[model samples]
Each structure stands twice: as structure tokens, then as C-alpha cells.
Target: MADERATTVAGNDAEDLSFALSCLAAGAITPEELKGWIQLALEQSRELPARVFELFAPGLANALVPGWRGLIGTWPGTSLSAAEGRAVAGIAHARFPELQPGGAGAPDRAAASAALRESPAIRDRFARVFPSIRVPDEGEAGVGCADAAESGAGAEPDPAPIWWLAGAEDSPLAPANAQRIFDDRRTAGDLTTMLESDAGSTLVLVTNRARVMIMLTGLGGESGHATDPLADGLSGGFLLDNGQEDEYRDRDTVALPRALAVIDHILTHSAPPAQGWSVEVEG
Candidate 1:
């Protein structure tokens, strides 16, 4: 039974998952985009709502690189339209030529996932691969998205909250408390608490608690310093050399993209702030 779920539509390396998560956590990929990737995968694969795509699409899309949209994009809603089915089949026909209908390795969806399609204990299959990752219930059949409601044909799933912030080991963002911030926009209460308030009042060391990164968008003392993050890449956030993981940062001026990529490559844990990471406002 355990051997049954090795459905390798894509790779599942730990470092790869960690990198994708780091980008998501470090403000490289907005949560909106991560949600977009999940919606795209779920749209086509009704067999989704399965954790494989629900929690794993961000990594899958990043890993797949270019062929992702064609591979995962599907019309959303109660039914898979005939045209939509053909579109998916067309993709499989092109990419995995031997794995489509009338080919050498063709296996219908029903045959491929018969074991998981209705099983109540679906979470059990992915536990070893992704510990600490939350698993959704084995939802009702034809349920649209694992995290959001159904949308119209060819539509996208509504965005869902995900990617927990690493508060402190002791105060790790509990599932319930995590949602309170919604996006990265941090509260004054958070700033005062996290930074002990020392910098310019200009660079308030907004802590990571900000909604998205400021990324040097308006790097000036005049207008936008207080709300800015310490990191200087887009959507803005900071990085630290925790001394545990091997570092992969870019030192040159053309840095943001590389910095983000570094975050993806360097972050092995993929969740929470690092240890000995006492918050401080860098002036």
C-alpha cells in the first residue's frame, strides 16, 4: 500500500521543497502567487485537494520551471469540461507522449489513483515525505479546491492563507494565531515588541512581521522607512546567516533576484525564524 502513492508527477527532494518554501516565506513569491500556483494545479487535477498539490504545488511549479502551466493548469469548477479534458490530454500527449491514452504507458486517472481517490486516510501516505506539513482532510469528492471554494469554468480558486511565519520556537505562529496578520503588513504593536525601537524611526526594523517586503522601493527617510523591511529585494524581507545552513547569497549590485534564489537554495528548514535570532533594529 505504501508503494502505491509514489505518484511522481514531479520530484520531491527535501532541499527543493525547502527552497520553494524559502522563496515563499522570504517575500520572493507573494502568497497570492503561491495560491495561484495551487489553484492552477487543482483546476486541472480534480484528484487534487490531495496534499500532493495542495501543499506541494509551489515547489512543483518552481521545479517544473517552464512546462508547469500546461502541466497543471485546468478549468475550475464542478465538472471537467470535454474541452478541458482534451486540453489536459493534449498536454500529456505532448510531454509524456507514451503515458497518454493509446500509448505505451497510458493509465487513466481512475486507474492511477484508484487507491487514493476515496481513501479516508490520505494524509498517511505523504507523512514520511513531508513531516510538519499540515494535511487537509480527505474532502468530499468533486470538492473544488482544498483551500477555497469552486469557481466558474476556466476560473481560478480563491486565495487561501498559507506559509506560516516563524515567530520564535516558543511562540511559533500557531495555526489560529498566524492568520491574524493576514498579509505581511506588520502592526505597530509588533514593531515595538520585535525591535525595541532604536533606528531612524526611519528604518524601524519592522522585523519580518511586515505583510510583504518593501525591497528598497522607496528607500528614503522622507516617506517610507518605518514600514520597510531590512532586506532590499522586491516584496522586501531580510536574510540571516544562521550558521547552520550553507549560505548562497549574492554580493554584487544586481542582487534581488539572486538574493531570492539564494533564499530558495539556502533555507533548509523552510519554516520559522532560526535559533539565536534575537530581533534587533539595524540602523
Candidate 2:
């Protein structure tokens, strides 16, 4: 059953790639635009995409070199659009002209992967062989424009047991807490300390978008509770509630587009005390 799940994930990833690529080939977005969406999707989906990509990464490596590596980086701290990300998917098509969604390849997949890994010269040759793809010099091609701050302080945030909230409204997690977060946003090293400190506190990290990340831990370890209630309510979409139950839904979901909208609103409505956080905007 686990294997089945893995197979399904891989197929879905291919479909996702196909869709992303089709969007790119249609000229709907520039490479820069695609990078942002790809970044978001990868974070939200976690390791799912990479597992699926194994089905075709070798074939696509020639055309996807720079883009694949760049896309990997965006998942953590950058934004990438789906359309632009299709360039990475197109790499597979470039490598194996006969390969397509639901297509068959070599009899022993592991052997092929082993062969590729064993030969550095063959790998280098493969990259150079594809002239039409235009692999750019690392220094020349750039990522996207948006600049995002690192998630935690150079250290860490006070991870002591506490309450956490989602959204940037004037709820329990209000301007004061927001200010605290902003104050601590100076360096990642500081933030790391906070996350590791408290075993029983609730930590809320808000994105410029309305989305939020919540961490719950306890002295004994961590609280494992029913998150389905919150997920069901928020999954289909629910009103922003300060209700006690809404306090911790275990894990929650916030769509990127909506999250961005929330972030924009926050930026427009309130300015972080300039003294607290370091600001960097990428052009």
C-alpha cells in the first residue's frame, strides 16, 4: 500500500509537471515568474515532487540544470510561478524524446540511475550535448525579484510553551505579539534559540501573506491532538475566528495567493517598527 501511494504520488507529480510545462510553452510566464510558484508548491507539498521527478530527472537534467537547482532553492525562501517552472519539466522531454506521461522506459530503473551516478564524464557530456537548451552561466541568469526575510532569528525565538494564532488580525496574536515577532526577526541565529527553547508553548509565525505556521510542544515532548476539526473547518474555508477552538488546529492550510493578499494588507496597514527588523528588498 505504501508502494501504491508512492506510485500515485509520482504519477501526480508528472501530471503536475506536464501542466506546469504546458503553461510555460504557451508563453504565459517568464522563467522568473515560474520560479516563484514552483517555490511555494514545493514547500506546501514537501518531498512529493522530488520522488516523482526521479521518474524523469536524468532525461530532463540537460535542459533543467540551472532551473532545477534554482527551483530547489526557491522552495525554502523564494516564490516561483507554475508556468515558469514548466521549463524544468520540459527538461525530461528534451532528454528522452520518446518519454511522455505514463510512458515506459528501461527494464531496470535502478540500474540506469546507478550507471548515471557512476560516470562523471558521461554526466558532463550529457549537459554539454544539449546546445539548443541554452544552459546559462550561473552568474548570468538570476532568480526572481521578491526578497523574503529569513524565518527565524539568527539564533531562535523563545520556544517556551505558549499560545499560537493564525492570521495577522487583532486577535490574541495581535500587534504586541506581532511586534515581538518583528523585534526578534533580526537574525536567524536568534530565532533558532526560540524554536528550541520551550517544549510546551505555542509559537505562531506569520507570513507576509495571511498564512501562519504554528508549532506546539510540551515538557514531556509534544501534544498530539485531533487536528481534523480545524482542518475540516479551514479546508473548505472558514471565517477568521478568535474562538477558543480555533486557537490550535494542530496544522492548518493557507493558500499562497490568499496568503500574499493578507501580507499585502498587513504591509499596507501596519509598518513594522523600523528599529526592530532588518529590511532587504531584492530588485
Top candidate, metric TM-score: 2
Residue-wise C-alpha lDDT for candidate 1, range 1-283, written one tens digit per residue:
0122122223322332333333233222434334433333333234542444433343453443333333435312223233333332332222221232434443343332332344323224233222212222223111223212222333452222222333433443322233233222334334211211111121122233322221221112222211112224333233322322122221111122122221221121122112102233458
Indicate the residue-level lDDT of 223 in model 2.
29
Worst 10 residues of 2 by lDDT: 140-149
lDDT of each: 0.28, 0.29
* Model 1 ranges off by over 4 Å: 1-106, 117-125, 140-157, 160-283
In candidate 1, position 125 carries an lDDT of 29
TM-scores for every predicted model: 0.21, 0.23
- Error in Å for residue 173 of model 1: 20
Tell me the deviation in Å of residue 19 in model 2: 1.4
Backbone clash numbers for all candidates listed: 6, 46
lDDT of 2 by residue, 75-188 (tens): 222122432233333333322222333224321222332343344443343232211122221121111100001222233322323223333222433323333453355233
